[model samples]
Target: MRIAVVGLGAVGARAARQLASTEGVDEVLLRDIDDGRRSEVAASLGAIATPEPQSVTAPPEADAVVLALPAGDHAAAALPLVERGVPVVSTSDSVGDVEALLDLGPLAEAVGTTLVLGAAFSPGLSCLLARHAADLLDDVTEVHVARAGTGGPACAHQHHRALGGSAIDWRNGGWQRRAAGSGRELCWFPDPVGAADCYRAGLPDALLLVNALGPVERVTARLAATRRDRLTARLPMLRRPHPEGVLGAVRAEVRGRVDGRYETVVYGAFDRPGVAAGAVAAVAAVAAVRGDLGVPAGAHGLGASTRARELLGQLAVRGVKSAAFTG
Candidate 1:
C-alpha cells in the first residue's frame, strides 16, 4: 500500500517513520510547505519528498492518507481524499468548535469515506480506551479522559487556547458548554507519573466520544500537568519556555459506571509520547487500507471505531508498553 503523510513536523515526522517501516506499505510520500525541512525529514526516513505543494494534494491511488498537519488544516487536507472514497487518519480536528466536529458525520457519509478523526496520543488512545471500557459494561453513563502534558512548543499555545475556550461536557442527556478549567479533579495515573490535578479542557474528542458512545451523562477531557506547566499557565514571571516533548510518561484514564457498577480503566505508556501518538495514527491509516477497521463511510474517532485490545496489542509490538487498570 502506498501512503502519504502530510506535514513533517515533530508529530508528522514520527508518523512518517512508522508508516514507511510498517509491513505491507510499499511507499511513503512526505509533504510540507517548507521545502528544506520537508526534504530533510523525508531523507532521514528514506521516503519520497514532494516539492512544497500549493495545497494538500494526496498522491493518486495512495490507498490511504495520514494527516499530521495542524488541526486547522486537517479538513481541507483530507476532504479531497474523502471525496474520492479514500480513508483518512487525521491527527487533530480540522474544525475549531464542537459543532464543527460533530458536523463531519454527515459529510463523511455523504462522501462514502471513512474518517478516523483526532487520532493522536491522548484523544486517539483515550477515545479507544473509552470505547473498550464502555464495552465492558452493558452501557456507559460517563467517561473522564486524562493525559499527561508533554507536547511540543505548539502544545503550550494549544493548552492556553483550550483553557480559554468553552469546555463541552455531556449533561442533561445532551452536550453542555462549561468554562474551561471548571471541572478540575485529582486523578491518579500509573506509577512514575503518579497523581496530579486534571482539569477540563476544550478537546474535540470529547464531542466525538459523546457521539460515538451514546447517551453519556458526563464527559471530560483533562490534562495532567507538571509544576512547570502550572506555573507557566499562571505566573507570567515564571513562564519561561521549557523544552518541549521530553516527558518520560504518557497516560489516559477512563472512569464511569458499567453494568451499574462503577469502574475505571487506565492506559499508560512509558515512551516518548510522539512515538505513541504517531503510531496510533499510522496504525489507523493502515487499518483503513486493509478495509478491516469496520467503520462505514462516516466520521469516527480511532477509539470508537477500532477494537481497543487490538490497538493495545499493536502498540505493544512497537515496544510501547500500555496496559489497562481496574478498581
Candidate 2:
C-alpha cells in the first residue's frame, strides 16, 4: 500500500523513513512546500520514497495519509481528505488543531473515513498510555499527563505559545481554565529523562481524555520548562530550536479505585520527541491502511480507539516502548 506523508519536517521526515521501511507499504509519498527539504528527505529514504514538490491542496492517491503539518494547518488539510474517505493520521498537538480535528468526527463518520487525531508524543502516545493505565483499573477517576522536550523547531515554538497561552483542565466534572505555566509540579519520567519541573500548559490531553475515556473526576496536562522558558514564552523565541530536539519523554498517571482501594498507575516513554511522534504517526497510518484501528469510521484519539492495546504493542516493537512505574 502507498502512504503519503505531508510536510517533510523533522517529524514528517522520520515518519516517511519509518513508512518506507514498514512491511506492506510499497511506496511513501513525501509532500512539502520546501523543495530542498522534500527532495532531501525523499532521497534519504531511498527508492521507496517519492517527493511531491507541489503543495497538498487535495488528497493525493494513497491508502493512508500521515499529516505532520504545522499546527494551524492540520484541520484544513484534513477536511478534503476526510470528505473523500481517505484515512488520515494527524500528528497534531496544538489545542486548537486537535479540537478542530475532533470536531470533524461527524464528517468522517458520514464519509466512512478514519481520522486518527493527535498522533504525536503527548497527545498521541500520552493518550495511549492513559488508556493503558485506565485498563488496569476498575474505574478511572483522574488522569495527569506530563512531558519534557520538544520535537522540532515548530514543536519548540508551539511549546512557547502553550506556556504563555491559557491552560485548560477538567476538574470536578467541569472544564477549568488557568494560566499557562502554573501548577508547577515535579514529574519523573523514565530513566535518563529523570525528574523535570512540569507546569500546566495549553495541552490537549485533558480535552481528548474527557471525550475518549468518558467522564472522569479530573484530567490535567503539563509540560517541562525552566523559569526562563516560562518567562520568555510570551515573547518571540530568543534562539533557533534544533531541527530535531534532544531526548524527550512523556508520562501518564492514572488514578482510580480497584477492588475498593484507590490505586495509581504510571506509564512513561522516552525518546526524541520528534522520533516518537513520527513513529506514532507512521504506525497509526499503517494501522489505518490495515484497518487495525477498529474504529468503524470517524475521528478518534488513541485513548478511544478500540485497538489501543494492540497499537501500543506495535509501538513497543518499533522501539517507542513504554514502561509502567514500579515505584
Candidate 3:
C-alpha cells in the first residue's frame, strides 16, 4: 500500500517512519505545510515528501492517506481526500459529531473509500479495555478512565499557565467540566510499568464508551503528573498561551461493576506530547491503509468508534507496551 501521512511534525514524522518501515506498505508519502520539514523527514526516511495534500491525494499514485494533523485540522485536511475517493484513517482525537462525520459515509461509499477514526493510544486503548471489561460483565454499572503522562515543555507550560487545554469528564450521559486534579487519586499497578498514582480528569473516550455502552452509575477521568515540581513551576502561567512549554503524563483507569461485583482495569502509555501525538497518527494511518476502522465523518473524539482495544493490541504487538494494573 502507498500511504500518505499528513502533518510532518513529531507525531506525523513517527507515523510516516512506521508506515514506511511496515512490510506491506510499498511507499510512504510525508506531507506538511512546511516544505523544509517535509524534506527533512523524507530525507531521513527515504520516503516521498510533499507540501500539498492534493499532491499526495492525487489519483492512483497514493492508495491511502493517514492524517496525523492537529485535532482541529482533521475535517479540513480529510475532506479533500474524501473527494478524491481515497480511504483515510486518522488519530486526530477530534471526531466532534458522529452523524455529521459519518455523513461522509455515503460519499466514501460513492467513491469506494473508507474513513476510520479513533485509532490512537488513549481512545483506542482505553476504549478497548473498557469494552473488554464491559463484555466480561453481564451488567456494567460504571466505567472510569485515568491517563497520566509526561508532557513536553510546551504542554507543561500550557498546564501551568492554565491556557487552553482543560481537563474534561464523561458522566451522566454527557461531558462535564472538571477542575484539574478534581478526581480522586488511586494506586494503579500496571504490568511492566508498575504502580503509580492516578487522579481523575476529563477524557473524550470515556464519554464515547459511555455513549456506546449506556449509562453508568459513575465514570471519572483523571490526569497523573509525572513531575510535580516541573508542573508547579508553571502553575502561574495556566491562564496564558504557552503551547510550546506544555508537558505532562497520562494514565487511564476504567472500573466496571457487574452482578454486584467490581472489576477494575488500568492502562498506561508513557511518552512526551510529540511522541504521543505521533503514536496516535501512526496507528490511525496504518489502520486507514489496512481498511480496518469504523470512524464516523464529521468532527469526532477518540470514542466515535469501538475499535480502541483492537488498536491497542496492535500497538502492543508492534512492541508498544502499555502498563496494566489489576487489584
Candidate 4:
C-alpha cells in the first residue's frame, strides 16, 4: 500500500523513511513546498516526490495521506484530500484552532472520509497509551498524562503556545478551564530519563481522553522539562532543538476502581518524540490503508476511535518502546 506524506519536515521525513522502508509499502510520496528538499528526501528514501501535495487524491487506487505539517497547516493540507473522500491522519492537536479542526468532522463525514487527528506522539501514542491505562480499570475515574519531550519546530511551537495559557480539563462531568502550566506534580519516567516535576498544561490529548473515557472525575495533561528548558520556553526567539542525544518520553497514570478497589494503571515510552511521532503517524496511516484500524468516518481523537492496546502493539513492532505497568 502507498501513503502520501505531506510536509517532509523532520517528522514528515522520518515518517516517510519508515514507510518507505516498510516491507509492504508500495510507495512513499515525499511532499513539501520546497521542491529541492522534497526531491532530496524522496531520492534519499528511494520513493516518489511531489512538490505539490495539496493536489494529492486518495481512494479507488491510492491508500492514505498523512499530514506532518505544523498544527496550523494541517487543515489546509487535509481538507483537500478529505473533500475528495480521502482518509487523513494528522499530527496536530486541539490546542490551536480547536474549532477549525473540529469543523473538519462534518466535512470528513459528509464525504465518507475518516479523519484521525493528533496522530503524532503526544496526541497520538500518548493517547493510545493513556487508553491502555484506562483499560486496567473497570471504571475509569481519572486520567493524568505526563509528556516530556523536546520535539521539532512545530512541536516546540506547540509547547510554546500552550504554556502559561488557559488549560482545559474534564472535571465534574464537563470541560473546565484553568491556568496552563499551573498545577505541578512529580512524575517518574523510564530509567535514564528518571523523574521530573511536571505542570498542568493545555494539551489536546486531555481533551481526547475526556471524550474517549470520560464524564468521569478528572483528566489532566502535563508537560515536564528541566528548569533550564522551562526557562527557555519563556524566550521563543531562542528556542533550541532537543539536545544532541536525548530521547523523549510519554507517561500516563489512569486511576479507577478495579473490581472493588482504587488503583492506578500506568504506561511509559521512551524515544525521540519528533521521530516517534512520525512513526505513530506512519503506523496510523498504514493501518488506514490496510483497513486495520476500522476508524469511523469524521474527525475523531486518536484515543476515541483507535484501539489502544492494538495500536501499542503496532508501535512496538515498528521499533517504538511501548508497554504497560503493574506497579
Best by lDDT: 2
Q: Candidate 3, residues 138-235: lDDT per residue as tens digits? A: 66667666544423333333234321234555555566665554444654534333455654333345545665555666666554544452345434
* Candidate 2 collision pairs: none
How many Å off is the CA of 118 in candidate 3? 4.4
* Regions of candidate 4 where Cα sits further than 4 Å from its true position: 47-62, 228-234, 242-245
- Give the clashing residue pairs of candidate 4, or none: none
Error of 2 at 37 (Å): 0.6
Q: Deviation in angstroms for 312 in model 4?
A: 1.3
Candidate closer to the true structure by TM-score (higher is better), 2 or 3: 2
Query: What TM-score would every model get versus the actual structure?
Result: 0.87, 0.98, 0.71, 0.90
lDDT of each: 0.69, 0.90, 0.56, 0.75
Cα RMSD (Å) per model?
3.1, 1.1, 5.1, 2.8
Number of the candidate with higher lDDT, 3 or 4 = 4
Using TM-score, give the best candidate's number: 2
Give one digit per residue, the lDDT tens place, for model 2 in 19-68: 98899999998899988898899778889988875854557789999999
lDDT per residue (tens digit) for residues 160-219 in model 4: 667646778888788888876677789888766779888767677666678787556888
Return the candidate ranking by lDDT, descending: 2, 4, 1, 3
How much does candidate 2 score in TM-score? 0.98
